[model samples]
Target: MDAKSIKEEKAELEIWQYIFGFTPVAVVKCAIELEIADTIESHGGAVSLPDLASAVCCSPSALGRIMRYLTHRGFFELHESTHKYSNTPLSLRLLLKNGANSVAPFLLMEASPEMLAPWHRLRASAAPGGGSAFRAVYGEDFWDYASQNPAVSKLFDDGIASHATRAICEIIERCGDVFEGIGCLLDVGGGDGTTLRYITEACPWVRGINFDLPHVVCVAPQIRGVEHVAGDMFKHIPEADAVFIKWVLHDRSDDECMHVLKKCREAVPKETGKVIIVETVIVEGEEDEYSDTKLALDMVMMAHTEKGKERTFEEWDCVIKGAGFSSYTVKHIGSIFSIIVACP
Candidate 1:
């Protein structure tokens, strides 16, 4: 082919990737729904086509197409000689059967009909005065919709709980110093006290107040050394030696974040207290492993929330300083999010 012709063909090829992206997502969702990974593990981590089809209640021929697609996408493996399929390394790590690192529930939540409805209206949401895509679909914001639908609320809680547990544990492990000398730590916007439970368990010396809204804290389970306090963070935060917020600030605008942060600043003792924040700090155009994931989550925030977003470092600094925090330091724990300590 001529040079110009080759360039045109390459451009077409690259555009096709965007067109084909939804197929893998759909196929993977189907595979997880069928419990394909768990079924394979049950058969000693490998299964033949007929056996797998029978187990998941599909015809062999139809299941074969799914298996072919999944294997090619590297979610599962195909043994050339035996013609059996087994879990790939990626499958084992993300399946619900495994703990902590599993993204199964989160993936299912994102692919759900209710959640996907907003994505369809995303373009309209981006236009001037379009407002939130989620609100457009449900006639209310995401949090309001969750509060009204019990099943959806539980599904989202389960999804976030699965991943947040892992992230919290890593923070306690690597950034233990943040908790040192903290007699009482208030977890702002702590849902159901899960994050506070992990924190108290790790640092027995610390007492925890799981602070959130009345409805959210109402259903929280009892944990020793932790008190579930129901209130609005925007209004008032209970006094404590230190305050910790995990992935909560991202769900607000810069003004809203500063509002919450200023309250956090007030809740602690001005002389010795500090606020700990766990959030993603996006670095634009950086080719790091997690940079893309952070950017993707920023897009999710755009489609799903009014002003929620992941912030860049300078943006974070702006909010921190705007919130009246004098200075702060960030520590990365080898995950998509980082731990930030802001001093009063």
Candidate 2:
């Protein structure tokens, strides 16, 4: 091929990467299902292709192809001379056993057919008066479907909890000061009480209320010093010294957030109480390590919810003001989320 033709062809392939990017996601899901990372880690972080394949009960040739692609994608490392595989830092995070911060469940859920099917209908959902692609494909809202399907509900819960574990830990370490002087804390829409469990454990003096829908509270395991309560956030929230809402508002419209924030304002004392919100705040013209994930999640929110979308600082200010909060402050936590403390 001519030099110019070759250069153009390479550029086109780069563009094609965006079109076929789901390939890596699907492959990662396969690795999770087969516990490939766990298998390799079990063998002291390295294993021959034949042995690894045997442990996973798959054909060596097929598994070899999978490993080749994973290694090419930096998820694993290959020892060329020995024809063996080992876990990279990325792969270690997917290990099911004894691996710190495993996101296997999250990967599994995102790569599931149930989740991917909705993406095909994104254009339709984006049209005016059109609803979520999830609803378009499933004939019901994502939360409603989860309510009816026990398995999906469990997966959803587990996936979210798994993903939140590390983030919640970081928040406590980096922003634990937010809990000081709080006698009672209410976790609005705290699914399964995971976040509160961490908080109450870290701050033993603080009592926590895990508030969510009745069905969600019914399945939450009881934790000492954390009380589980069932109610809608739109209508009422139990009184507390501090009310915490994490990853909830982005799944709602401005009108809905205003309603919930108003309830939050009512739940806390005007003198000292505050509302703590943990979510992604998109800032225009600002680039960081989390920019890509934040933007990608914004799209995911659009595909899965009727009106939910990420907000900027100005948008957040508008909602906080609309809810009658007098002042607020934001602290960026890690790379993906921010902690906004709002006071009445």
Best by TM-score: 2
Candidate 1: Cα lDDT at 44: 94
| Weakest 10 consecutive residues of candidate 1 by summed lDDT | 92-101
Worst 10 residues of 2 by lDDT: 91-100
User: Once superposed on the true structure, which residue ranges of model 2 sit more than 4 Å away at CA?
Assistant: 1-11, 80-82, 95-100
> Candidate 1: where are CA atoms >4 Å away?
1-10, 97-100
Clashes of each: 0, 0
Top candidate on lDDT is 2
Alpha carbon deviation, residue 66, candidate 2 (Å)? 0.5
Candidate 1, residue 233: Cα displacement in angstroms equals 1.5
> For model 2, which pairs clash?
none
RMSD of each: 2.3, 2.5
What lDDT does each candidate get? 0.86, 0.88
Tens-digit per-residue lDDT, 123-241, candidate 2 = 86778876788888999888788888877877777777777777789999998999999999999988888888889899999999999988788999999999999998887899999
